[model samples]
Target chain A: MSMTMTQKILADHAGLKEVSAGQLIEAKLDVVMANDITGPMALPIFKQMADHVFDKDKVVLVPDHFTPNKDMKSAENSKAIREFSREQCLTHYMEQGKCGVEHAILPEQGIVVAGECIIGADSHTCTYGALGAFSTGVGTTDIATGMATGELWFKVPSAIKFVLKGELQPYVSGKDVILHIIGRIGVDGALYKSMEFTGDGVASLTMDDRFTICNMAIEAGAKNGIFPVDEITREYMQKHSKKVYKEYQADEDAEYDEVIEIDLSKITPTVAFPHLPGNAHTMEEINESEKIYIDQVVIGSCTNGRLSDLRKAAQILKGKKVADTVRVMVIPATQKIFVECIREGLAEIFVEAGCAFNTPSCGPCMGGHMGVMAKGEKCVSTTNRNFVGRMGDTEALIYLASPEVAAASAIAGYIADPRKAGN
Target chain B: MKAKGTVLKYGDNVDTDVIIPARYLNSFDAKELASHAMVDIDPTFTQRLKPGDIMVAGKNFGCGSSREHAPLALKTAGVSCVIAQSFARIFYRNSLNIGFAILECPEAAKDIDEGDQVEVDFDAGVIKNLTKDKKYQAQPFPEFLQKMIQANGLVNYVNQKREGKL
Candidate 1:
């Protein structure tokens, strides 16, 4: 009978008293997002239906994935989005490298807020749930509908409480926690609910760690993943949000469909194997005595390519050259983060380390033009998901790991341990 | 709601990438999308599917991706309704917004088969697999959703409300 966090957020946003899971509700959207991959296709459909742009304030068009135009198709698509943003007089259209990723840059730019519903045409839109917003990704067509009408309808989802305790191990991080959670839940668990990650462990996570967890919520089949606001969230708000706002939390007795407890301390540095996040293996499971072949090592995405992620990768890669056989690709999540890395000389280290540092884009993460994998190539990536051919040729393999794992693997030319490589 | 269809059946984890693959990502037309719908996962889905065949699938149906085209492709493929045990968040929201019926029936797929003749009453939230004498619960549509479904789609629903025709 009690309103869960998502229900509460929806109620308040929709101007209602309360709502329940599976109950249809008309809610006001706090932010609606679309990326270059989806926006160019969906925006034209929106134009076909309506004569004018919808409310520009709520719309955010981000040019990521393929930025600065990778090819003719990508170039034209980015240009089309730019033209649409101009025609609509939208203020939130982030150009190449200006916004690292729709999922990353928006929150840092203060577009994502606590206790609201956000939609993006990019699946990674679920990443915003880290801030306690009920965000999810939709198709371009649905975005077109949202653009025409300022309102969208949602059936409140059953919430799954992921209660965490203990602490992350030295080499382990939030990415490990999520991978472990996924390992426990299996590929199909949390199929249709929001995974609200809470408990003592949550409070200990820095914003970046929390982002890493929420960013992969989609892989678990959850609509969104969320963490309650805390001091770290408050600090992030201070730096990002121009206009400060109040925070909301779940009621202590709030009802949930299911609750899971995770002992963060028990988690280890994990790798999502051959084809899915659920196929997890702890470092001990890997035969480190033997070498693995890798064609690429990418340490970024909206998932783990934040400022902290870059710093972590830089720490591992500094003074070490990427393996002769490996091509290390480092992508910053946002222009601000990219600029900061340049200012700190971290970008220079990556370049000097035999790494190919690219401009801010979702590049290689989605295999959208930049750094796409060839058939049979093996890649260690900080990005989430390893669905077959998800990154490129079906024969290519993607290993999901933390930035530390990815960078170290790049240097060793295989799936190597950062600590061992550091030594 | 102005829905006319029998029914079809599918299994779980029916992802969007399966509905319309990235190979066809360049095409934007609903008709073009319809032709390729489920062609990846169910190679015969488009060819064998008849007009107005509602699809009933297992839990976590339509997971992955934010492409609204997944729903549009189904609609274009003549899928009248989608009765699933569960649906990923984005697909569910997008389906309702685009005037597609997505009912949560925890036991829907378990009770029905591929050739089942089905009838769904949006107001009642009930699915009748007329062939098997099986029935499933589809949570009745809320006021907002009922109106949208009745209007045939989001655009029409909004337009009707704006014109004071609802």
Candidate 2:
């Protein structure tokens, strides 16, 4: 049977000759992950099922969501997971000071690699598919099961093929590409399906761009988003990971539910308006309407907090001061990336530009801390989701955009096109 | 298996954030979580929600975040089951893992109105709207899922398997 990349990987892990869409199979997991919030929730269930995890090395715990102890409650929750990790002697537990967002650090630390089946207790776990892994999010109960027995059930997903052509225009990054796709397909466009990206245009995207694209696959309700392993992927793996990785390619006859063609060059710097990621509009469309103002700008998150994302923001913010009316917060995804930003003087640029450069945390992205909005406020953020009440009061609004747009908006106090904004 | 309840309807993309906002996720107590369930969308959800109530919504229900707290919140708040036109992938698995009942039926989801009395027959894959005097068909759970529900949840099922009682 001819199988797609996701199917081939699942079949190999399941010890099956072949599998098809919607077929249920129990497959071995290469990695099982949870963060502070879900980690503590799964402990009691994990204890009830088994005294020890199936494999300590295979289990990873990162305290990120409300880290730096947002409050007394978050502090206690962090302690619970900390103690649990120490008790289990888990191989991949990251302490608060040393940790980053789960999705960002996992790939950066070489914990998740190609041709692996990984599950995390966070929706953005699909981010690893950028590295050619079959990864998806699960609940606390699923995490408990995975910890107790390094295996979990899966329903193989049918796929949607996105064929890309042409190179992206300047100021357009992977965030725009994904936001454009999500807007076109609506939030649930790829529900219960795998989004497989291919075409020569793939070669033009940096690894950071691919990671950004795959990170928000969940925003479109995709089970996962994957790219075929290429020279760029191999190079990234060689730099970060010591684990030998395997590569899988879809057969020529691989069945796809639908095929969508995307012209990367035509994708302008895009933004998803209030409420839904599917409410996407390009800068041209947005500029033609009444100018939308904002009270705050957040230029970081797992979605666009990588090195390239930071560089883009810093380049635009170097000499420009943010609007006196808007508050700008820039957060790196991990501790390592944070230090690298400072070393590269991007930190200096942000501070001199009157922006608050924060430590690595998912803060403000999920409205946990750092920059929660007030009632009747508006924000342009580089995070993935902009659901109602995501950042603060239900009345407040969120506009999802690329780092370039976010940085520019911080200066203009309204959503602005980066290319046209004064430097 | 069967469930009966009055419906509480919502529109499309009823996301996890609104179902159980991230601000309240610091607590693991099911009751504490339940107290705030759907508060973002309806500030009076906890007060209005009665035991054995059914929550109904339009397309792409539970669209954001993989926080199982969404399902746990609804289940603990006495939501007997949820009927939606469709559900996000992670939310679907999370519901079943916790033994929460959910059905996908476009006709019922579209026709069912707030405060309508609804009855679901899981074995027969039928949803009866008593208030509307209508019946709609939904896909039944597969054998494994049916067994998991019978065991009360995945935790119990795993325990039974470990003891060779499966």
Candidate 3:
């Protein structure tokens, strides 16, 4: 019997000859992670189980959400991880200056590798699947168990193959593609299934685009979203990855529970309206009928906060000023991305375009702190998960879009297509 | 283990942000998190829910962030268990790891109504609606997971294993 990439990785880790979807197997984890908020909670549970980590090198703790000590409580929360890392002598503890978001930094620092099984306490752990790793999110207690035992059980998930065809239209990025897919497939469409990207269109996507796609897989209730490693992935690995990894792919005969075909050229800059990522609309659809105004435009997060995303946004924002009524904030996903932005003068461009530049953090993406929304305010954000009250007041609305659309919308003070925005 | 509760029904794709909201996640206290549970969707949720109530929901319940806060809030708010047609993968594991009861039964989820009196027998893996006089078979927990929950969460379960007490 042929197996998908997910099955092959799980079978190897579990030391089984073969495994199928829905089969429960205990597998060793290559990397275990938790962010500040979840890590602090897991610490007490970890203490209850054991005083030390099972493998310090394998355990990674980073404080991205509410980091840099947003408040006394947040400071205390981060303090827990800091103390635990010191006590355990963990090798991968990312301090404030060293850390960005967990998802971006993990791969950037070569902590998350290809063909490995990773479990993070945060849900976006699926982001690493872009690198061909079998990664999933767990809760605090699950992190505690993984920390103590370095192993956890998984019920292998079936695969959903998304075959992409045609070239992406101008400014129609991976965010638009993912939002479009999520719109077609309801929020629960891929429940407990892997959404695997394939075909020529996927090959045309950059690693940044693939990361943006996989990062939002959770919005469609997918266990993980993955892309096969190709030359682009190998190039990315050469620069950032510390260790060599074996490339993994699904067999041509591998069975998929469902197959979805998407034409990239048919998609345009899209936005997920208030309340859900599934309520997606192309810019043309909204421009045709809706009269919407925006209060803020946030361009960042694990979804679209990489250097490539920043450069794309910069391309749209250069020599243009944001609308007087709308505030724009651009945050890099990782410090490395921020440094690269500075090196490339993207920071200067954003500031010249009247956008506020923030240090790398989850920031307004989680609504935990920084650039929070007010009641009745509307925001176009380049982040995943637009559920109500996500960015601030429950009355405030969030629109999920690509960084290009977000930047274009910032200039227009409402939802606008990047193609029409004066570049 | 057996439990009984009144049902509080929710709709599909009830995500974590609405479950606890990110604004209130600054604190690590479960009780504090419980105070604001479901307020975004139903402001009177905490006030209306009685202790040991059961939450019945449509498919893909808990389908957003992997924050344990969602399950922690429900459990802290005295929800004994959540019965749904399906659940988001992480949320399902989070609920089990926290020792909160969650049963997936499509028929029960479809048939159960709000304010229904429900009883669950974990050993028998069955959910009975006393108000409707209906019984639905639930997927039984595997032996290992059952032991983990029996030990009152993964923490205790792992502790026992380390000490050879399991």
Residue B124, model 1: lDDT of 76
Off by over 4 Å in 2: none
Which digits, one per residue and each the tens of the lDDT, describe model 1 over residues A1-423?
A: 577777788888788998877777778877888877788887666765676656888888988867766777777878888998998899898987457777789988998777778888887788877777788777776677678776676667788899999888766787888888888897668766788988988877888898889888888987778888888887887788875454678889888888988888888788998777788988777755466679998887898878889988888888988889999888888888889899998999899998888788877776665678898999999988786656776678999999888888888888877767754
lDDT of 2 by residue, A1-423 (tens): 899999999999999999999998889999999998899999999998999999989999999999988999999988998888889899999886686989999999999999999999999999999999999999999999999999998999999999999999989999999999999888999999999999999999999999999999999999999999999999999999998799999998999999999999999999998899889999999899999999999988889999899999999998989999999999999889889998999999999999999988899998899999989999999999888999988989999999999999999989999999765
Q: Which has the better DockQ: candidate 2, or candidate 3?
A: 2
What lDDT, from 0 to 1, does candidate 2 have?
Answer: 0.93
lDDT of each: 0.79, 0.93, 0.89
RMSD per model, one decimal:
3.4, 0.9, 1.5
All candidates in order of TM-score, best leading: 2, 3, 1
In candidate 2 chain B, where is summed lDDT lowest over 10 consecutive residues?
A: B140-149
- The DockQ scores of all candidates, in the order shown, are 0.37, 0.89, 0.84
Give candidate 1's TM-score: 0.88
lDDT of 3 by residue, B1-166 (tens): 8889899998888888999998888787999999999999999999999998999999899988889989999999998889999998889989988888899999999999999999999888899999999999998887888888898877887778778998
Indicate the residue-level lDDT of A222 in model 1: 77
lDDT of 3 by residue, A4-119 (tens): 88888889899998898888888999999999889999988887777788998899999999976788998888988999999999999998776698888998898887898999
Write one digit per residue (lDDT tens) for candidate 1, span B9-50. 787777776677654555457899899898745779888888
